[model samples]
Target: MTYCVGMMLDRGLVLMSDTRTNSGVDNISTFRKMYHWELPGERIITIMTAGNLATTQAVISQLEERNKAPSERHNSLLEAPTMFKVASIVGNLLQDIIEERATDNGQKAAAGTFSASMIVAGQIKGMEPRLFLIYPEGNFIEASFDTPFFQIGETKYGRPILIRGYERDMSFESAIKLMTVSFDSTLKANLSVGLPLDLLVIERDHFTPRHERRIEASDPYFAAVSTSWSEALRNALDGLPDYRMDPAVKEILG
Candidate 1:
């Protein structure tokens, strides 16, 4: 299992993903789940995947191969005219890979098994930055004002922080802090999602990544963020109004 998040903000977009895959407790391994394609001032695309490692890797490899080929189908990421089209290409490729693999193995493909989901975010020249969550069925939905972020894998533990703190117009610094809090929540609850996290920030209309960093286990900044967030949460919880039962209710309970 893994955890990946893509947040849409007025400043641009923020993406993060963990780098761990395991079939069993004893069969753990490390593999990057984030992939990016850049065309300098023309376009920039980042994809973070979660699901079967083999399936996701195959989909990415195929997309890269198509970009290298001389095909005219506009299947290449570089050839995509809009961020939406780029997401469509990726979603279709992922669906096809899962289907082909399932057929080869003589098993029926279902949404829960071979299917993989991805978060695609970036911008093309002359377009605004966009973020999408592509499902395993070759379908996707874009992030909007009402829902400004998307998360995959072990999402439950991390969702509350985003729900309470996210803003579409937040500064990049605040967005990163909120995302770090979300990630810390998931890391504490799910052992399957381990670190060495990949984080990418794309500025609006830049058509290129503004910042990218890898947060390892010993990163000082992440460490401080984690510590501070936990303390803040503890303090907030301590300050909540205490339960006070009415006299009649208390007497009944006694």
Candidate 2:
């Protein structure tokens, strides 16, 4: 399992994903799940994946290969005229890979044993930045005014934080802080999601990443954020109005 989040903000876009993958408690490993392709000044595309590692890897590898081929192919993400088209290409590729794998294994695609999902976020020159959540079925939904964020993989544990804290116009600093809290919440709840997270911040119109870094277990800022969030949660719970026992129920128990 893993966790990846892509948040759309007025500033640009913020993306983060954990590197942990495990087959069992005894067999754990780390693998990068975030990838991006940029055509400086023209466009920038970033994808964060979760689910069957092989399926996601294959899809990414094929996209990379297309990127390296001639620009005339028009099959490359770089040559796609808009972010929508880029997303279509990625979604189709992801769906095809999952179906192929399932067929090779003599299993039904609906079995979902070989499924994967992705969050594709970035901007094309002359357009407002966009964010999408692509599912295993080759279908996707874009982030908009009502939905300005996407989270994939081990999502439930961290979803509440995002729901309560995300804002469409928040600064990048605030977005990063919010993401850390979300990721930290998941890390505490699930052993499958661990440290060494990859983070990328793309500023509007830059067509390139404004900030990119990997937050290892030892990263100071993440450490501080994790500790602070825990304390905040405890304090918030304690500060909330206490639950009072019903008098009749209490008397019966007594």
Candidate 3:
């Protein structure tokens, strides 16, 4: 299990994912879950994946290979004319992989053993920024004005803060700050979701990443944000009005 979030904003798109994967409590490892392909001024595509490691890696490797050598077997992410088509191709590929794995595993292939999903975000030269949450079944939904973000994997523990604070017009910097806090909440609540975090930003019409980075356990900014959020929560709790019995009602009852 892992956590990945992508936000669509008026300025651009912001994406984040944790780098932890585990087969068991003792068999944990770090693997990058975010991927991107860019053609400088032409297009930029990013994918953050969650689920079975083998399935996601296989999907990514196949995409990378196709991108390197354009083939009739599949449409390369680079060759897709629109972001919508790019997502369709990716979703189809993921579905094919899982189905193949099930066939190979025969009756032994239980549910979710070879399942995965992705958050796809990017832009083409003339198109606006777009975001999609692709499911394991090769279907997807685009982010809209009413829903400006998508989250994949161990989601419940971190969703509340995003719901309360997200704004579609927020700056990229502020968006990243919000994302970090979201990850912080997940990290504290779930052992399956751990650092380091990969972050990427694509500004409107740039056709290239505006910001990309990885935040490790020792990252000072993340450390400070985590500390500050804890303090803020405590302060908020303290400031809330407490419930008390009405004095007149208590006296009348007595």
Candidate 4:
């Protein structure tokens, strides 16, 4: 299991993902689930993945290989004309990989063992920044005014925070803070989604990342945000009006 989120804001985009991957409680490992490709002043693309590790790795590797080899320019992420086309290319590659894996193993296509999903966010020269949620079936949906964020993997635990706090016009700092709270909530509820977390922030019209970092277990900012969020939740709960017994029930009991 893992947790990955891509948030669309007026400023640009913010993406974060957990590093923990586990076969069991005793066989956990850390693997990066966030990747980015860039062509300075032309375009920048970021992808956060969740699901079968092998399938995700295969998809990423193929993209990287195509990116490096000039002969594969037709399918290269760097050569994609628009963010929408880039999302389509990635979705198709992801779906094909899962299907190929399933068939090679003599199982039905997209069997549970070979399924994965991705969030693709990026901007191309002369185009608006876009974000997409790509599923294992080669179809995807873009983020818009109605749905400005996408979450994949172990999503239930952290979605409430995003739903309650996200704003389309919020500043980048506020967005990152909100994401930290969301990730902290999930970390407390699920062991399969542990840190260190990879974070990438892409500013509007900027073909490169505005900020990128990995938040380790001991990162002061992360620790402070986690502690602060926990305290805030408790205080909010305490401040809410308490439940009272019905007068009729009290009289009957008396």
Candidate 5:
């Protein structure tokens, strides 16, 4: 399992993903789940994948090959005129790859054994920044004002922080901080999701990544944030009012 989040804000976009994958308790490995494509001053796209490792890797490999071909291909993400088109291409590719794998494996392989999902986020020149959650069925939905962020894979453990703190106009710094806090909660709650996170930030209209960092287990800043968040939660709980029983009920019980 893995966790990836993409936020669309007034400042641009923020994306983060964990690098953990495991088939069983004894079979664990780390693989970078975030893939980026940029055509400086023209377009930028970042995709964070989760689910069946084989399906996701194959989808990314095909996309990369098309993008690197000598001639621009219509299916290439870089050739898409708008972010919406880019998403369509990706979704279709994912669906195709998954179906092909299933076909080769014969009829008994279970319907969703190799299912995967992706979070696509970035900007295309002349268009507003966008974020999308692409599912295994080749369908996707974009983030709106009411839902300014999208999270895929192992999402339940960390959704509360985003729901409580996300703002449309938050500064990039604040967005990144909020993301880290949410990720910390997941890290503590799930052994399947571990350290060495990939972080990327895109400034509005820049058509390129503004901030990028690989946060390892030993990163000082992440360590500080994790500690601070735990302390804050403890303090908040301590400050809450305790339950009080009615005097009559207390006397009766006594």
Candidate 6:
């Protein structure tokens, strides 16, 4: 129903997510899947979610509420000592919400229904930029040089490009371009994933976002990227060696 990606690069991190939710072919809506919290020079955290809209929204709401409470019994995003801790907190919250919803309804919630997964990326003042893929079970895995990116929800259509082109030390510009291309591939193959993408870039050790953008359907850069990528793919496919067989061999096989 949605697609979100977070890439960990040597220079920084890049995150992007689509903004579409649908109950059926006739019922469709747009809702942002990206959320960010910033403490200026101290910390910056961004979360991109994919799954049941209600469940994700509730988790985010509860986190925000806890952060604002006078006697915070737990570490909110702002209070987390490290990026790993922040991810653990988010994963736990997501798991709790899913369990509560499933218990109240007495049904096994389908994947991406009462269940959700998130990509958490950011930095605290003393730590390096980190990226995590938080699963529905309250456990997560961080990106490493071997696996420098994480994607969730409707991901299969977009994963090939990342697999072929991703580099751990790529520049910020190249990373965003690769991400845009990945999103473009998904958009072409799936109707459930739609436009108005949210993109955020954080340079290493900045403790703040370097770039944040919303790419609407009419955005020129997005349009150009999509068109160019399509053309390039077509050209590449055309250049691949074609299969040929001798007429006698073909007839014998037939």
What TM-score would each prediction reach against the true structure? 0.91, 0.91, 0.93, 0.92, 0.92, 0.90
Which scores higher on TM-score, 3 or 4?
3
- TM-score for model 2? 0.91
Model 3 CA deviation exceeding 4 Å by range: 66-75, 246-254
Candidate 6 ranges beyond 4 A from true positions? 66-75, 107-112, 247-254
Q: What is the C-alpha RMSD of each candidate to the true structure, in Å?
A: 3.3, 3.6, 3.0, 3.1, 3.1, 3.5
Model 5 gets an lDDT of 0.91
Candidate 5, 132-191: lDDT as tens digits? 999999999999888888898899999999999998889999999999999999999999
Worst 10 residues of 1 by lDDT: 66-75
Q: lDDT per residue, candidate 4, 137-237, as tens digits?
A: 98999999699999999999999989999999999999999999999999999999999999999999999999999999999999999888778889999
| lDDT (Cα, 0-100) at 27 in candidate 5 | 94
Q: Per-residue lDDT for 1-254 in model 6, tens only?
A: 99999998999889999999998878999999999998989999999999888999988888888556656544389888889999999999999999888878875655435999999999888778899999999999998888989999999999999999998888899999999999999999999999999999999888778999999999999999988987898899999965557887666666
* lDDT for each residue of candidate 1 in 120-205, tens digit (9 for 90 to 100): 99998888889999998889999997888999988999998899999888998889888888999998898999888999999987
* Window of ten residues with lowest summed lDDT in model 4: 66-75
Best by TM-score: 3
- Each candidate: what lDDT? 0.88, 0.91, 0.92, 0.92, 0.91, 0.90
List of clashing residue pairs for candidate 1: none
Candidate 1 shows a clash count of 0
Alpha-carbon runs more than 4 Å astray in model 4: 66-75, 246-254
Q: How close is candidate 6 to the true structure, as a TM-score?
A: 0.90
Q: Please give the TM-score that candidate 4 achieves against the real structure.
A: 0.92
Worst 10 residues of 3 by lDDT: 66-75
- Per-residue error for 148 in candidate 2, Å, reads 0.9
